[model samples]
Target: MRDPAPRAVTSICRALAEQIERGLLTAGSQLPAERKLSEVFDTTRITLREALGQLESQGLIYREERRGWFVSPARVAYNPLVRTHFHAMVAEQGRVPATEVLSARLMPASADICELLQLPGLSSVYQIRRARRIDGRLVLYVEHYLNPAYFPGILAFDLTRSLTELYASEYDIRYGRVRFDMVPTALHNEAATALKVAVGGPALRIVRVNRDQHGRLIDCDMEFWRHDALHVSVEVPD
Candidate 1:
């Protein structure tokens, strides 16, 4: 027999969650009033309110004082200290991961790229642009710049594969340390298009500079993600 007390609330929450996940209830869509939801689920008003509260805590819905509830946009979390690749992170969350390679080429380093990589003027750099997805939803736009000498034939490698793993297995290039800076930003046209958000949508811009075991700059990467899609966490040891 099903447990009766929480069943009704859970059912309502699950139905709403499924609709949100399947895009039937889109972001910013206003949910029905509590009475309507209770009637729809054949439950009491208190139970319906509990279900809405649960969804709100999961970042799936928001309640306004007088406006009822609206769908909360999706979000993702990023950890700078983790050494794993993007694919691994998404996989660990049981979300599908995919990448669209926008551009990859060998080019002379721009001044900023040269400075970040500590390369001399005119040194070759492998520049790659990719759009990342989670469960078929566009989420991140990334641009990576690498020292060509440190990662030859990188452009030819399967980019969807883990770059860190490829470097470790093939060239013994491993990240010994990483530095990250984050800032709030508004999505630009290209980033908005890649991330499937409107222009001026809130974003978290992360810039990472990774160094190899030898203390040489290995890669400089910039990532832009929808602000609603991610959470960041750090655990401290006692």
Candidate 2:
């Protein structure tokens, strides 16, 4: 006879999915404990976990490392062609945005960073690491590598604010051109830790290279976002 565990998993998944869709489980609200949920479903913990995993893959729920699962909020629409910054875009979508600076220092540019920023070998760059939250949920971890020659004393400024505004206000330079590269990836150590997700969980990686109005490469940002947190959208003019 074929196994019945798959059926149990499917049943539980459908039940939970209905609850979420009907708003019985609100967005960002933590699910009940695993043991409680398993008992409620009258199934083995393994089966319940499988069901939860399926929901997670479907973007209806998410898990944080050491923390229980939560109902996922609606995805934020992301338009790469827009020139707006992170805070602005997120706010425009009616979500509260907050950023925390993790680290900032002047460091020797790695070969990869140098290539992205068009810097010579052995040049130093200012590196800034940050975590961004939408409506109090951590969603993105980013690292920014800036060509030091362009911004002197940048470390003295507040790093938690939008770098785009900072560049224009302090340095009188604005972003003119940008390139984007994105791929689905497994969360690495640092990004996973920062986002409080399990190592190797699914993530979306976006690498952005920016040039100033003078056509000089100014910075590059590597952003790792929760895969469920974004909906990519773009409009092309005829």
RMSD of each: 9.4, 1.6
Task: Write the residue-wise lDDT of candidate 1 on 12-66 in tens digits.
Answer: 8899999999999998788887888777788888778888878876778755444
Candidate 2 Cα outliers beyond 4 Å, as residue runs: 1-3
Off by over 4 Å in 1: 1-74
TM-score of 1: 0.70
lDDT of 2: 0.94
Query: How well is each residue in 99-209 modelled by candidate 2, as lDDT tens digits?
Result: 999999999999999899988899999999999999999999999999989999999999999999999999998998999999999999999999999999999999999
Per-candidate clashes, comma-separated: 6, 0
True lDDT of residue 67, candidate 2: 87
TM-scores of the candidates in the order shown: 0.70, 0.97
| lDDT (0 to 1) per candidate | 0.81, 0.94
The ten-residue window of minimal lDDT in model 2 covers 1-10
> What lDDT score is found at residue 171 in candidate 1?
85
